[model samples]
Target: MKITSVIARQLLDTKTRPLVEVEIRTDTGHVGLGAAPTGSSVGVHEAFVLRDGNPAEYDGLSVHHAVASVTDHIAPALVGAELDLRVLDQKMIDLDGTSDKSKLGSNAIYSTSIALLRASAAAAGVPTYTYVADLMGLPPVSTVPVPSFNMINGGRYGDLTQPFNEFLVMPYKAESIEQAVEKSVKVFKVLDQLLTEKIGHKPQVASSYGYAAPSADPREVLQILAEAVDRAGCSDIMAFALDCASSEMYDKTAHTYELNGRRVSSAELIDYTRQLSEEFPLVFVEDLLDEDDWDGYTQAVAEIPKTIILGDDLIVTNRERLERAVELSAVDGFILKPNQVGTISEALDCYSYGQDRGLLAIPSGRSGGVIDDVVMDLSVGLGVPFQKNGAPRSGERIEKLNFLLRVADSVPHCSMADVSALVKA
Candidate 1:
């Protein structure tokens, strides 16, 4: 089928959510819908074209806009040309047409590619995952694990720094959910104290409805989480993980420091990490070191217990960088975010690479916007044990949750994995 026209829309759900919706129509009248919601980067939509008379200027292009512009520009060229989307995506990346090497790009191209894949799958009368697995020579899967949720601490708190909204979550146990939230209040209060002591103002702290643990004082944090899990009514937490994006930041001498435990220092950062994982039921730690501290990251990974050390910012999504990370043994898990890399195929490649290394390849959505339900399909199709979307509240977070629920209901033998159990296992 040849392309007929492409229409796009910019929708804002609230101050925290902004999405670019694109509809591609074929000459054969087959219509496919795709979108990339950039919650943190709203300017990307403006950099793209409107259905009006004149298109917007290129100067308006953000990373997201650059992504969408590819669809606006390249979709027409491929029209009437019999081509496979996988190959087309490869060509786009090969030509660096939307690589965003300059760091000014969008995930719009990724959305466009997903739209084409959706259209191709519909035309073939197969599931999206089947098509991807068939093309990539990966096993097809029916079920995947869900993130316990980071937005809602048993519906007790919200993200205080960025947007203000409540999160919905399935608590650890009805009782622990309350306790965990109560602990969160204390933890954030402590964090606020630390921040106030350092930055002269309390850093607004957000609580995850279900998943509540910060990078500071991992042993104590895990205990608090375990208590929350028990209070929530789960048999056991199964596993504990740490989101350590600030790992490198704490050790930097130039940056301001605080008293995490007798004053946070470089040695203290690594020491605390090791202590927490060894003392508590820690399973994974993401971005343990700064993105650039490969040497420190390698050393830290080696010294820590055999927990899954994951990388998001550190590995970014470039194949070369990923290959380097693997060579250095920098991590044990990979967090796959399409926007981080900018294409589904690229993300899949990262997932596959991690899988080959016996590492968990997790595909994640974003903190904002609910585009289409392609990510849910991709995770199951690829057999990822865990996924990192957001809390089970609001449109951006609920889109993935609803997609999984619908899929589980329709597809027999498919259901949300006991996320906690899967993590520990």
Candidate 2:
């Protein structure tokens, strides 16, 4: 069947920012819905996210132009095209000749592309995840991944001015997503309690992810979270990770990165991260260096060879950038942010590239995600997957976890991911 029409509209995410939500109607009247997620800590190399610049409307972040572009340019062109992955995405790339998808906006492109995938699956009477797997030559997506819950956020996510961006925990030995969630929530609750006791105020919510606490010392925050792991009785299943997002805090003029009121050189940052890995059950350290710091990434990877040195902005989910990372011997893993690159095929290709090299493929959610749980499904389709979809908060973040839990409940014999393989003994 052909794609009959694509309807797009400007909408608000849970963060009250303007977002684009899309609905694709096929010739058979099958419909699919999708939303493009954005982030507070954006990578410079990422594809464009167009917005209106007028201050009066939507605080200069309006997506009305993008919505218009999708309706006026994108929809009419793809209306009669055959419904499939390659054709639609290729036509989109052809329409927007820029390498980084600036002309048409990555938000517009991703929302429409995602809508096509969902609508195609609905038209074929198959689950979206199953359809994605079949298209990618993957087996049925029966593996229920352990969810990496970002229980604490900082450096633009909330009022907390911590150096690192995200502090998350997941259950490593849980038998299923349900069990993983159960174990993680216990840690989150205990962490919340500890933060309240430490500061005489409850940890405030940070966006769609975890609780936010005021602490200058990253190790202290980890210590509190570790205690929560102990108090929850979830040490058997629980493990922690960090998203440094150091690019934001790096002072290029000063040639040092900001860290808890101190200037940290790249070497110093690497050493600090190395210490954290040695001291805690930190399986992943993402974006530890500035995006363009290949030497820094190589040093960190060399020093902490066991933990997953995931490249978020370092690679920006682009295969060419990933190749550059390989050439530099920078990272052993990469974070998959779908909007960063702009298509399902490209995202799958990024995962395949990592899989070919036996690198860690950690799919993650954006800072201001919408309600769709497609990321959770995409991660599960990768088999024994790991994902960062935010904490078990109400709204869009929990929607993703709920989707995983349903996947586990609906599918029989789904097992926990073997994350130990990616970590030091």
Candidate 3:
């Protein structure tokens, strides 16, 4: 497909935050729409999320610069270009020529890159995942990723009194994607009911992941998840995952984390994460330490060998950063956020790198997402061992989850990544 024109629009994501979406039109008359969802707890190494105009306006967050990059620069740069995914994406990166995509915002570049992927796949008349798999030189395996269900949210997502950001119900033993989602939903409901009975009312606040409850205790969350899984009659089938988002809590200057008013030292936090991993059915943990705390992650990952130590902020979806983490043995896997690196191809490279190092590659869509199903295809295309999706309630979250279900049905030999050994390890 020959690229024709590119356009950018400033839209609001599910969290009512400024987001940039790109629409790419090709000579084939196919239009591809792509979205980049911003997160409140972003990593320092992540590509600059730029804002323009007055600081007082819209919290000093605007997409005018990003929009201009797409329409004015990006659009002209590739108007008559052939949509070889790698070439097209690299053109944008080259145009910027910076490590963190400071010239054209990562949001602008990624949104456009994603839209190009979709448009090219559409012109080829194949499933988006299949096209991506071809680009990655991987066999088209219909592997349903292990369900890393983010069933509870804390920190930037909502109710930051709780130090832990995500309470995940991992359906490690589920036989299929359908069964996995079922187990997740049952546990979520059971937990909701338990919260209602223990507290005054059910957690009616719907977060990006799951029901947001006002609690700051990780032990309490662990206990509640166990009870909920047992009550749902799936104790053996489901385990827990924690996305601590510790960078959100870590005070860089003080070098101590504040948890519910207590100043927690790095050693204390690592000890606590290890404690929770051992005491609970925690199969996976992400960002348990500050992003820059290399020693802290090394210690935590060493102690929690059985649990999959995943890195989000620690790696920031960059292969160069992933190499540093590997050298330190700081993490076992990565939460691949494409926008963090400004290209799906780069994100795939990180995924491939993780695979060569015997690391888990988890393609993740941020919580405050959109209705676009690009993440759904990206997860399937990468053939990740796991894909982190949000809770069952939010309509925005359901769109991707439902699309996964449909993808599973479309592919003949769809198989889910079984985390049974990791959970029991």
Best by TM-score: 2
lDDT of 1 by residue, 100-167 (tens): 52222344555666777776766666877777767677755566454445432221123312111222
lDDT of 3: 0.82
What TM-score does structure 3 among the candidates reach? 0.94
By lDDT, the best candidate is 2
Q: In candidate 3, what are the lDDT values of residues 1-425, reduced to their tens digit? A: 68888889988888787788999888889878898887767899998876675577667677878988998889999888887778989999999899899888898999998898889888889988888888888888668777677776775434457888888888888889898888788888888888888778767564565767456788887787778889999887777888889988888899998676588987888778778877887878889888899998888887776688889999999999999999999998888888888898898888889899999877777755888657778788877767788777778777777777888888898878765655633
Which wins on lDDT, candidate 2 or candidate 3?
Answer: 2
TM-score of model number 2: 0.96
The true-structure Cα RMSD of candidate 3 reads: 2.1
TM-score against truth, every candidate: 0.73, 0.96, 0.94
Superposition error at 191 for model 3 (Å):
1.6
Residue 229 of model 2, lDDT score? 91
Q: List the residue pairs that clash in candidate 3.
A: 209-391
Quantify all predictions' global Cα lDDT against the true fold: 0.53, 0.83, 0.82
Query: Which whole-number lDDT from 0 to 100 does residue 340 have in model 1?
Result: 60
After superposition, the stretches of candidate 2 with alpha carbons farther than 4 Å from their true spots are 156-160
Q: What shift in Å separates residue 343 of candidate 3 from its native position after superposition? A: 1.2
Pull out the clashing pairs in model 2: 151-210
lDDT-best of 1 and 3:
3
